[model samples]
Target: MAGRPTIYDVAERAGVSKSLVSLVLNRSPSVSEASRLAVEEAIAALGYRPSRAAANLAARSTRLVGVLIDDYTNLWFVDLVRGLRTTLGEHGYRVTVADMATAPPTENPVEGFLSMRVEGVVVAMDVPAALSDPAAPPVVIAGTRRAAPPDADSVTNDDAVGARLAAEHLLSLGHRRLGHLTASGGAAVVRRASFVEAVERSGATVVTIEHDGPTDEQAGFDGAIALLETHPETTAIFAANDLMALGALGAARQLRRRVPEDLSIMGYDNTPLARTRLVDLTTIDDNSFAVGIEAGRLLLDRMNDADARTGAGAGATSDGHARATHRTLEPDLILRGTTGPAPAAAP
Candidate 1:
């Protein structure tokens, strides 16, 4: 078997000392441009891949970030993770993701992240208070600002504004009696509240159905059935998330209600599914990718500062409670085929 090439091999090929090769590979700014180029040339020629583990050891940085998500089936979560991966990859950091399927009850996710010795963590779910430990590494919440721990930083969409946008769209279409399907938890609750507020502000009435289940197709469908049964006068429905919105569409079909003609529907997240010709759901674009990017940048900054503090023996401090830093990304209203002016008022 052939032995793996090491820094020594690169040094020999580039006619430089092993220390010089190490310095160049580590991106030491002190190395001359010529030396850096020569080392790179040799590395490319040898088809060598630098050992990230070894590099991390030498630099005292794991360069690993942990991401905890509530569910993986949702396309919105998938897109957010993709955004985080892209941004973190650009900064030379890898992500370790954990999906706590259907709302984790314990702190195992936090424990798992801590066990990995990740430089930082991005909690993409509404983690319980018990799950948040001050002793753990820096943590940031993504998606909903409502679940942000007192001591944790967060990035969220302007859900209130987004909800209002959806409400306004429906109202503009002459929707009067409205129904909202909401997921359980802080984010969903806030969005539902905003929707109700918008309806009231616009001189309309809103009937809300809270679903305490995963924000998936099934939950949406079930919620829709109940909502329609209870509020037969509802002319439009707004789902807290896109997945549920799709479910609601399915429920409407089962009840023989034609979309836009019999009812108008709006969903949030504006996921890929919403764009499909079959669904064509009018939704609120949360700009999830931008949220992921911002979260990644925040995590990196926290890691770098923590690294610097530990190196200087200054001890790292938590930013979770240093003045509620909430970042609300703007959301846009996407009009699609699912929503239209309310059908001519029944005779």
Candidate 2:
């Protein structure tokens, strides 16, 4: 049986100490360039393969990061994960993904991540209260506003600004009675509030239809049906997400309501679904890739400094302490085929 190559073999070949070989392989900044080169040459000559587990134990850290996502089927989530992988890979970290698609709502994803001994965790779902463990590894939450504990961090697009932009677009098109189809719960409420505020500022009446469940095509369809039925005067609708906006499009088609001519609809998240030739939904670009990239960077930073304070592990703070270090990206409106000038009033 062949034995594994040892660091001593590399050190002997390079004419360096075992510590020098270890430092080079572990990427320690303290090692000189000449020393690092010698270690690399020695490693090549000896055909040495470093043991990841042993290296982690020696350094008291690991390069593995665990990412938890709400739904794997959502293309936006897929893109976000891809962005995270690309960024983390550049930093010599491997990502382990866990899809909580079928998990019960009450299950603690953070606990699962902890079990893996992940140095850091990135959550692409709504923030969970159970993640408030100061002793745990750092965490980064995306796509939701639930504040991380003092020890965790988070990254999100400017959802309120995105909603305002969508509402303003309709208002600019002379939409008076505007209706909103939005997801239920925390993030949706913020978007709805922004939309209503924007409409109110423009002296327009805002009628909102809140979905009973998660934001999806079904919610969009059902919400649109209710809104159109209750407020026939509504000339425009702004959905919280592209999926819901697509649902609104389906509802309009079913009712024989000509788009842009009879109504204008806009959505957030500017996902690929909105760009389909069949749908062509006008939407606000939340830049999901950028969000993922930022989240990945935050995780890397945490890994670099294990003692750093993050929002996820710190729990609720006083107003002053709770001031979230949120990174809010601006949203741009992409006008496609769905949004247009408001239809003229019926003769």
lDDT of each: 0.79, 0.75
TM-score of each: 0.79, 0.77
Error of 2 at 278 (Å): 1.8
Off by over 4 Å in 2: 1-62, 104-108, 307-324
Per-residue accuracy of model 2 over 291-341 as CA lDDT, tens digit each: 889889877655543321121123211323234356777778899888888
How high is the lDDT of residue 165 in model 1?
A: 92
Q: What digit string (tens of lDDT, one per residue) describes model 1 on residues 14-54?
A: 99865566556556555789999999998898876656544
Question: Which 10 consecutive residues of model 1 have the lowest summed lDDT?
Answer: 311-320
Q: Against the true structure, what is every candidate's RMSD?
A: 9.1, 8.7
